[model samples]
Target chain A: MDIKSLKNYLYWLYCQFELITCSYLMEPWEKLLFYTFNITMLVMVLYTAYIFVPVHISTAFQFFLHLLGNQHENTVSVVK
Target chain B: MANPSAVCNGHLHHHHQKQNNLLKSGIYKKNGITKGMKKNGVSNGTLHKKTITEHFEQAPMYVAVLTFLGFGVGTIFGYLRDFMRAWGLEKRNVAAEREQQKDFVPLYQDFENFYTRNLYMRIRDNWNRPICSVPGPQFDLMERVTDDYNWTFRFTGRTIKNVINMGSYNYLGFAETDVNALKTVTIELQKYGTGICSTRQEMGSLDKHVELEKLVAKFLGVEDAMVFGMGFATNSMNIPALVGKGCLILSDELNHTSLVLGARLSGATIRIFKHNNMQSLEKLLRDAIIYGQPRSRRAWRKILILVEGIYSMEGSIVRLPEIVFLKKKYKAYLYLDEAHSIGAVGATGRGVVEYFGMSPDDVDVLMGTFTKSFGAAGGYIAGKKDLVDFLRTHSHSAVYATSMCPPVAEQIIRAMKCLMGLDGTTQGLQRVRQLGKNTRYFRRRLHEMGFIIYGNDDSPVVPLLLYMPGKIGAFARRMLEKNIGVVVVGFPATPITESRARFCVSAAHTREMLDTVLNALDELGDFLHLKYSRYSKSSHPELYEETRLELED
Candidate 1:
């Protein structure tokens, strides 16, 4: 998932291997199915990030506020 | 303080003379004369050039991967924090942030300070650490502590003493004034107080300023030179004076920010070539000549090539010989900035020109700063008399900015005299030789330790790559805790994965001192998993054996 290994992997795919299955072996219907699956998966990940992050962040914020309520001045100089 | 070093310098000078005689006679194959100054000397008239910069090696794949992953995770966390603040789930302590402006648009964007709050805050203490002594080989850093996740810091009333200063650009040890230079500086102080409070172009050109300029011209082997008050302004102001409207500036992409600002302000059409890549430069030069200016199709008013003697961040020396050839072929003007390399480079310390065994006339403009190697406050431009004459009236630094301080000028004069052997001693030679030796030894040791470092092996700015952003702060903190000062850079200044800690090796560093710092680095490397190199320099295969599976494999 890191940039460099991904680059090397792509370089290997582009230089050493031929795109046989996707370019030649796949039928029109299968190709359409593959494209649909990829598009849907990417959209789903983006959608989850859009919807779930706010809730997770609000909970974390509430916890932080609760944790720092009473001894705000002392904790301000002592801890995070 | 000075006598022992003078004695050491005398011994080294004699040894150098004996080796020089042998080298000329072809008795020896050039081994110990100087590590990085080998084969290229003013005595020899040719430069041995390299295609790609050799010493700046790439790190192992894992370091890059880990760095990106850290940044990605950090970015996601940053977004989450931003969302929390924007949606009012988390409230800022500031009263203004809590106030709502009814029937009006919000004045501030919530994510405006996202990078600062989310990313930089986590590791902000690594930089801008205040030091309380002369930034020589050893200095004192005032310690401070932070609470509430680096939102603010308060001084702890403690100073870290005897901290080995590997972070400063005091290359020739000029920042540390010895007894001899101190006496002369005091005399100059009485004569000229601190500063003249006027511009050189107005009334501030004193005897000391004139003498310093003449000495600088002689030291650089140029016809004339002009002094300026500030180093950054030396380029940012003077470049506009030289080139403007429709002029083409073929600048290196890795050129300094000052140079970038100067080029932009010049109102010139700037074309960038890959750093030190002669092929890319040649392609640009050819296209520029063929294409000429935009729309109208006339030739550019002038083609000026801008490059630095040694790029400070990358620690790479300019391919000056090759660049000169390209300049001559394209009939372009050459502007060389030796800010970091002036008194620190070359066999005779004349800079990149002397290092390449090329004549001063090979370069059209010779620009450098006294702030680095000279350990003074200003900069200078030296070339032909015409260039200096034109810059005298036209350059903003010369015309508007106040003249350089008198004592600073005297310091530069004394330092330049020592560099040119006018002080009737070889201490300058010894310093240059020591710096070259220190640089090579330091780089060789880092390479042997399996740490990836950038720049020429001879260049004093040794950037040791830490790669991981997390390790950037970790390395600096650990080194400080071990009583060593280091400078680390991440993100904005460099590509995220190329985060590094740059060690500016100086002639002032003793072998024992360097070894102590190296020992600290070795322990840190082991703990931090920083040994990322697959190759080792000549020896230390055993060191590589320990990190092989953990790193490259």
Candidate 2:
């Protein structure tokens, strides 16, 4: 056989192994849909985390600053 | 339950019809009638055919999910702990070894053994329990205590005594062969001392070795036989001597690692068939013949099928009848390893061939070990005289390793003599029959207890499923506490969810001893909640029946 045909044959042979009978290996359309759902879920998680984490971290930092820095300033200036 | 053979027969009927279609398609030339075609083209009549029943209980769907999830969560946590250790947030008391070895290129690669440090270490006490006595009906395990999380253990110098041995592979109770073969030991030891101090290929070939080989060949009903000092080496070394570059080896997926190594060393094109699945084997054989050797597209010099008579871990017998049929039809060589089944099964302790009433000539290569059943050390390769002659000159074990010791050979000779009734006693016959009785009774009782069991009822190697990895150690330690020793097998030797406690029922075990083990499992089953099989009707019929119906609902 030609190199291209042999490569195609080998790839077909590789796909014969049912890698994920538990949840995966399905009809092409169903597999495509399932993979779309998975990729979407991953993207949504990444987007939500990207939108939430830094703001939350900064807010928490502000709160901690009020607890430590404000108390030190009030004690030196107002209490004295 | 009414007729167990019906289940297996139904399976065979389905396969027969499916393959009949394939046969009609003209892929097969001769001997294609797989079900009942016997030697010399004799068609199987009703009296000539027998159905061998084998049952393997599948875990419930939820159990599989849980096992998969458990493995995943365990892996995540393990990697997280590794990250923490890397960040110096966690400290291990067992860093002593790594710290000392940090000098040169880190000779011992313990870091790569992630499973050991994380999962295996947690349950390390269940394995390698030092036994202080002969592994007969009962033995003593030296007690050990681990303070630093099984990293280092200090033996307490005290032994747990009189524990019922449910884990040893003394199938014919020939483990006491030393005691039984005492009469012959004097002459055996006197003539050829204890050790050979030489390899068999050169100076180590003693008179006893020659006699043992001849006797082995006679016993197996083969042309010739060669014995090896090590059982593992028998496969790992001899296989390469048989097949090489231009050859093809179709090995069972569950074949012993020795066979795998040997197949790799032989430089043959190796293909794996699904374990004991004839359809998968047929597909592979067809594909192999069609494809020929890869790249070159040249016909393989030879095609060999490697299978085990009884898989040690799985406790299942190979479907030998069908394999032989397939081998004959496809013109491939058959290699049968009867290491666990040789003296453990069959009517007269011949092996799976005798168990199935098939002739030994059907197999091209017959290999077996004396370690399990003969109460001796070493293994043998029995086949055509040509194979033996070739192996004698080429096999690395025969050429390099020390020969089988004199006393061990004597022990084996005595065991075989007794088994063949040449010793003028029915003791061997009795042991073989007793083993079957014990195996069946034990399996049935365990089945009735509603526990999930694996393998055929006739197999002496009984593996009771404990899905949760935690239960592997729990069942083992609890059984040890109850004075019954059992072996626990778990990941990564087996799949994560398929962890099981294996019990090897010996002919040495009396009815009462078996009863004691049953009682222990009965109590432990409830305590561990391991009785997950709703298929079986338990002793308490009404109670289990109600539960079964409720679950079905």
Candidate 3:
């Protein structure tokens, strides 16, 4: 639907592919190569998450502040 | 046109004309006018016309709309029915839960689990990938992918050439690229086309059939002979005709399955004698003659003793002289199946009787197959003229099955002629002698190697016993990797734990080629720890002596 959702869908597809291929890669050397491929995919996903983390944390903090303000107003009204 | 009554009259007139046209075309018919219409003092045609006009005027739009509604509802119903069917297929049927009860598998399902899933069968599948070349000294076999770590089999579909052939029943190597056999085959192919396309009883038999029968009878010194298309069926189909329910059949324990099956189909009481054990056979014969039959206490109409010239599995030669003595003593007929022994044994290659210096007449029914010795096809029942004639008329195999292909029969005839010294060459006799030499040389070498082998010393069929079921696959794999084709047998062909590889010696094999095989086997035996029977070398030296004595006789 959106760029972020599309990216998530692509990541999901890659994870499924990796899982299936991991089972198929049975030899020790093949597993070792697959392990390297898995680590690379993990690192790429981590880097993407790092780029979007600042915006995500700020938005989460603002939502928590608005909830606290509403709670305080409700408490004052009850006291009155 | 604007006046309502005038417009209505014009529409009525058009409808009346259309009705009249339909009546003239004979599309509509009326039986007889009703009494009420006749009594109305108006004619029947006028009354009928009035009734039709009245009916058409009433709700023509309603009828069309009703028809469309019916069609739409019917289509919707059809779609719903199809959707329900698909949905039912997606779910498991509760009614079939009875079949899912524990251990309630169908017979075929049990077979799949027991036989198809067996380890040896799996190994066999991997061992025998089809060969592209002739089944001779060297041929190509498709490689099987059984290695680990492959997600899927990436079939190379390429053939490996020049793999030493140690399988196939090409006893004298006649099936190989023999110039004489091939030339005969070419000529026969042109003369006979492919097959006769009819049963032997019909128009299938050609002059060549008569020629072959005569040659076989002459070669074996029998009065007459009859041939069947399939070697296996020759025994299974003909045996029943020879003996029936009132008869008794004493079969050797280790005879080929075809003989055992034939004896069973005869509906005779079957008694098994220990393989190549003359004493056991004599004891059985004595008891049968004395006791008559178990429950009936009546003497048997006839008693038939069945034995193979050479036991295919154990490679032991039948004690023909001793058996013949017992058959005569008991007044029982002897049926000797020489499917394996005919082509590979004796000085002249006439089979066991020739090897043992006995009369061919000693065997009442002399059954031998051309598949092994002639390296062609079909089998023959050779005996007295009356027996041959009787079988010709009554044998189900001859009557129902198509005769052997003319080319195959010709190949057999050519091979026979060569063996008989009629081809004006020493090549046939030389090949037979070479086969004897090769068989003895290979068996002796294997014995000297401390490898536990089965079979008589002179037998071309040398079975190297492994005794371990698990290692059969390993031995086969190792041999194939070394580019040698070998046949490995396990249960139920042999005992459960007595798995072994059967190596049939062909005359085409040179001394050097056999040594190459021995070298590979030695390495494999060492790697797999298969040299357990090293100490038990030549368990039956007396059996070897017996063969020598028979040869001397």
What lDDT does model 3 reach? Answer: 0.71
| TM-score: model 3, chain A | 0.46
Tens digits of per-residue lDDT for model 1 on B62-102? Answer: 55665676666556656766677768887553323335574
* Candidate 1 stretches greater than 4 Å from native: A1-80, B1-53, B88-113, B536-553
Tens-place lDDT per residue, model 2, B199-254, is 99789998889999988876676678999989999999999999999999999998
Off by over 4 Å in 2: A1-80, B1-48, B89-112, B177-180, B536-553
Q: How far out, in Å, is residue B216 in model 1?
A: 0.4
**What lDDT does the true structure give each of the candidates?**
0.78, 0.79, 0.71
**Poorest stretch of ten by lDDT in candidate 1 chain B:** B10-19
TM-score value, chain A, candidate 1: 0.46
Give DockQ per model, in order.
0.01, 0.02, 0.02
Cand. 3: chain B TM-score = 0.77
True contacts kept of each: 0.00, 0.00, 0.03
Q: Which docking class does model 2 fall in?
A: incorrect
Between prediction 1 and prediction 3, which has the larger TM-score?
1
Model 3: per-residue Cα lDDT over B1-553, one tens digit each:
1221132231222222223322342421242223322454433433122121000012234333433443333233334433554477333211232446747753443422343232333344444467787777667887556443221244577777788888878888887776645997889899998789888889989988999998887667667899889999999999999999989999988878888889899899999999777889989888998999888889999999999988777777888877887898889999999999886886767788767645576789999999997888899999888999999999999899998899888888888878766776666777788889788878776776667678777788888876544356557777988888898886678754456798999898876788899999887776555555534445525354554565454
